[model samples]
Target: MSEFGRENPQFYLTAPTACPYLPGKYERKVFTHLVGEKASALNDILTQGGFRRSQNIAYRPACEACKACVSVRVRVDEFQPSRTFRRIIKRNADLIGEELPPQPSADQYALFRDYLDMRHAEGGMAEMTVLDYAMMVEDTHVETRVIEYRRRGPDSGIRGRGRGPLIAVALTDVLSDGLSMVYSFFDPDMADRSLGTFMILDHIERARKAGLPYVYLGYWVKGSPKMGYKIRFAPQEHLTGTGWLRVEGEDDAQD
Candidate 1:
């Protein structure tokens, strides 16, 4: 790990497991550990090269004979919201997003627990304990921020912090190319507001304001309905065998 080796970080592959996105398929991952001062730089290179971060680990799908997992990103400066997206934005108008230090608290953990129970009960992160949640928030080598979305409170504008029950949370990484959404979750009961889409839209706007050109949306699985929303953001780029290509006029293009 000491030698830069053209800035290549050490990599390892995980054992095959049941693929959550695509049924009857096995999925493995090629991953690496991000630690020390160079971790941030390493993370940026890995993300640009198709890896996604979960805590200190950077990984990407490596299923044999399948390439359905394609990295996607919204061209922030050129993004045009669809009519549905606009509606979602309007629906969540009462919520205020406060960008705060990446420090996990009891409230965030409680919301995280509820989100996992409601949305991903059978998923891999279903069993993450409070300690795990804290590490997920605070254990980082890159520049990260936690954006907490809550109902507008009287003192929200002055204090710049959410006071009501947490409705949504996005742990984001500030990268040179764009803002990479490391992970995001919201109250599943509030599905009508489409908090998932709202968070992505917010990230796109935030990126545009910061002069970044893209908002990395991680991977979009071709046949996974759970991942279908990634295609809704128009004028996005999908990383293909050739390179990043603009998605054309398909409403729900798969990865």
Candidate 2:
């Protein structure tokens, strides 16, 4: 029996596969299902232990010989944006992000599809159907929200939401200690806006506004070019064998 009044979570190791982040390396994962009444609580615990949630599953790197996937979380209250990050925010000023319930829509799927085609056509999620996209958003038992970014309309300030076509979307989870960015995608045409980085900056601000201490940014591989952007946020903490340790670097200036 386990703490949730059932058998203990049965963990499984995934078969080794080509590492997505590094060339000539393989990767594996330890995963378990997040289900039932205790799913939310279990998710929080697993996440704190460095696991990332995808739909109804929580998984973490269990690679045989590689430890490149280090978990990272931004110190929301202590974060200071770089000049480059500030520029990204300024460039996206016309967009507004509205946090809505985890309900999928045709419009969102369209944007998701376009993003996949343009950015991740060779990735795993590129083949996902509309149904799969909806399941990703609505399958969770934990507290989750979808933040949709769009162009601000005339009534935006009054309603606190934007109108026009959806340009980006972020699937997030509200953990007891932080906000976990489950997944996010944007219109590839708007790459110049740096919407990806802007979304993270916004999430940090959102976490600060909600009195959260951290904003989980999932894994950051040290040598992976694709993951280098995560390190730009200052005063972040990286999970280590001992515990979560604050990373000190050139970007440590206080805001």
Candidate 3:
């Protein structure tokens, strides 16, 4: 079993399946349950070692012949937004994000369905019903939250919360080192706002305020157009075989 502590959590490996990110290739994962009193501490350790938490399970890529899925985390303290990133933030300045308990809502599910239908229509999560979406948000053992973004209202300045329809949602985990973005979805109609990038920028600021140094952005696969946007956040670290290494250049060829 993988080393964590004396508890010795049982580990398992999944059968090979077609990789969604890289076509014509298959992938596998090694995972273990994150339950019991020490779940939060164990999650922090596993996450730092490149494992991502999905519900109560912590998993990492275990492909035998391929290692394209490299874990990435933004160095929040060192991050300086580029001109393009600043523009995206400015465009989204009218919205406010509020961290809420891991509670499911009808509005969240509706936005999730729209996002899947537009962005990932043929993906695995496209067929998920409202119940599945609820489980995805509420079924967690570690410290997790749902950050909802909405249009700012007149009382937002005093209440620190937005009003009106929910435009975006981020299902995030609060690790000791930083925030781990498990999943995020935005209103497809707001494509011009670049909500995806804006959410990441907001998370960076949140981490900074919390005195956290990193913002884990999950796996970044080489040659995948969908994941290429992740590299735009400079001075980020990619988990290599040797350890976490700092990458600053905007070259996708290095991966």
Candidate 4:
């Protein structure tokens, strides 16, 4: 009889586990499945409320005594690219991104596997199989798109899609406020380009072009080196206790 309907989403709390983002701290999550006909609408509301989607699950950190996972989103219109960000764009000038339907491909799976093996070998998703990868891309009922990045070729102008080997892929959700980058992966060998940062810069630009006000970047955990780069993007807003607070000093430890 709850508002979630017959296919009611059953919420559960994860047992406390070693924090992946912080040392000597534990982390927990409150999660629910995002399925059924109302999935898309439910997803939108949850995302705005700081939940992140993975496959068919919507989860948000719910640590008992810690609130280190702060959701941050860039205000696209007000974002001014730093010199480094501009250089990143210049360095990747030969690349092109094509937005396509959420269909799984062997090439994508290969790249995904390579990324996991090289970057997140010990992470939870390292054991994901090909079928799991497919479900990750196709299990969503929300408005999603896969952006494939590749090098430009002779026929690039005509086809509009890039032609080199698949270097990166981003699973994005189109929302009323902005685009949510659910997950993205790049070739680890191309570390010099800093593809991870480059992708984020690209998304910011993309949001601007699309006339969206913000580009949701999931969460930023303070004291976590892996998540430190997120603070470098100036003019970002963090979801604080008082609501979305404009963050000025990158050193402010909200998370």
Candidate 5:
């Protein structure tokens, strides 16, 4: 093959695995590697086409006779926070998000461990060691960032950065069109503050300021409680056969 032909990504299909979100269902994926000098541009195209990034791979669900996983993106310009979402934002107002390089830290790992232990004890990532967490943070060829949420320090306003203990972290990919949240974790102790929802809200604001029109939120699986909060971010669009269809409210969202 020519250099150009060799550089083209070859897709692969994964063996079926038990679905993490849905009970008694198997999930399979069709994936491709996101590497080489073209990775960033390729990431943008793949993300827009409903594939999600994991390390150096881009994948989307390809299970036969099942389509529960629906890719969704928030419409930045049209988004209006609901009363509960507004409360989540206010509850987290004391926190400030600092965008940093995709480098892992001991503090982040500690919080990640705590989150998994408390919230996802039986989940697939429960056994992930520090090294695995590090790879999750750093193993990427795409344009990526690690956002650390921490309590505002005395000089935060002057420095434009937060200080003190880390409360949450989001692994995000900066795409040509929007910010794609690859993965995220938070301190389980702060669950009442709804840190997950807060992060998405924060990303929406960040995208708005940067003139980006969407915040890609991966998949929103119907009937999965774990995926329900996603649909609450109204004025969002769901990837469908006819392209992205706008869903204005929770009731409007469909499988």
Candidate 6:
């Protein structure tokens, strides 16, 4: 029996599929639905145990003969922005993040499509339709928020929200201890702004202000270039056999 309640959540295993990060490796996942009244509690527990929530499902890597995928979370209070990170913050100083309910919009889908087409044309979600994207955003039982980043406008102070077109978007979950970044995408054309790093930095600040201790950053795969950026956030903890082991210093990966 699991710790959640008298009846344990039923788990399902996914068939082996080509690993998106590492070549010559296959990946499998053990997943369970995140539903019912206890969903938020279950989400918090599972995430602390290294499970990542997608839509209404919470999943973890259960690949056979491999253990490269590691869960990571940033220590919000202790994290100080590096010189490069500082520049990224200053670079996007005009931008503001507005947290909205988990609702989808055509504008968001357009930006999402552009991001996928440019950054991940060959990725698994490349073919996701607008309706599919809606499900991805709205299909959740836990406390979820869709944060849209855009440029600050003239009346920004009064409105408390950004104006103009959306520049980036992040799907986040509010956990008892931290914020989990389920998914995020930005305008590929604004790559110079380093929006990805900016979003993480923003989340850390947001979590800190919310009195959260950590910012769950999903997984960081060893030797995978796509996941290398995750190691840049210092004072982060990696989920290991002995539980979350804290790591210091930042990896110098290309910005």
Off by over 4 Å in 4: 1-9, 249-255
lDDT of each: 0.86, 0.90, 0.91, 0.87, 0.90, 0.94
TM-score of each model, in listed order: 0.92, 0.94, 0.95, 0.92, 0.95, 0.96
lDDT of 2: 0.90
How does candidate 6 score on lDDT?
0.94
lDDT of 1 by residue, 1-255 (tens): 466732466788999988989988889999988877788888888888888998888899888878999998888888887777788788987888899889998988988999999989999999999999999999887899999999888887898666668999999999988999999998888888889889998899889999999899899887798888788787889887787898843554432
Clashes of each: 0, 0, 0, 0, 0, 0
Cα lDDT tens digits for candidate 3, 109-146: 99999999999999999899989888888888899989
lDDT score at residue 21, model 3, on the 0-100 scale: 91
Candidate 6, residue 19: CA error in Å? 0.6
Please report, as a residue range, the 10-residue window in candidate 2 with the lowest summed lDDT. Answer: 246-255
Flag the better candidate by lDDT, 4 or 6.
6
Alpha-carbon deviation at 115 in model 4, angstroms: 1.3
Candidate 6: segments with Cα more than 4 A from true spot: 1-7
Top lDDT model: 6
**Model 6: pairs clashing at backbone N, Cα or C within 3 Å:** none
Looking at model 1, report the run of 10 residues with the lowest lDDT sum. Answer: 246-255
- Report the Cα lDDT for candidate 1: 0.86
RMSD of 5: 2.4
TM-score-best of 4 and 5 = 5
Name the candidate, 1 or 4, with the larger lDDT value. Answer: 4
C-alpha lDDT of residue 55 in model 5 = 97
Top candidate, metric TM-score: 6
Error of 3 at 23 (Å): 1.2
Q: What is the Cα-based lDDT of residue 199 in candidate 3?
A: 97
Model 4 whole-model lDDT (C-alpha atoms): 0.87
Error of 3 at 120 (Å): 0.5
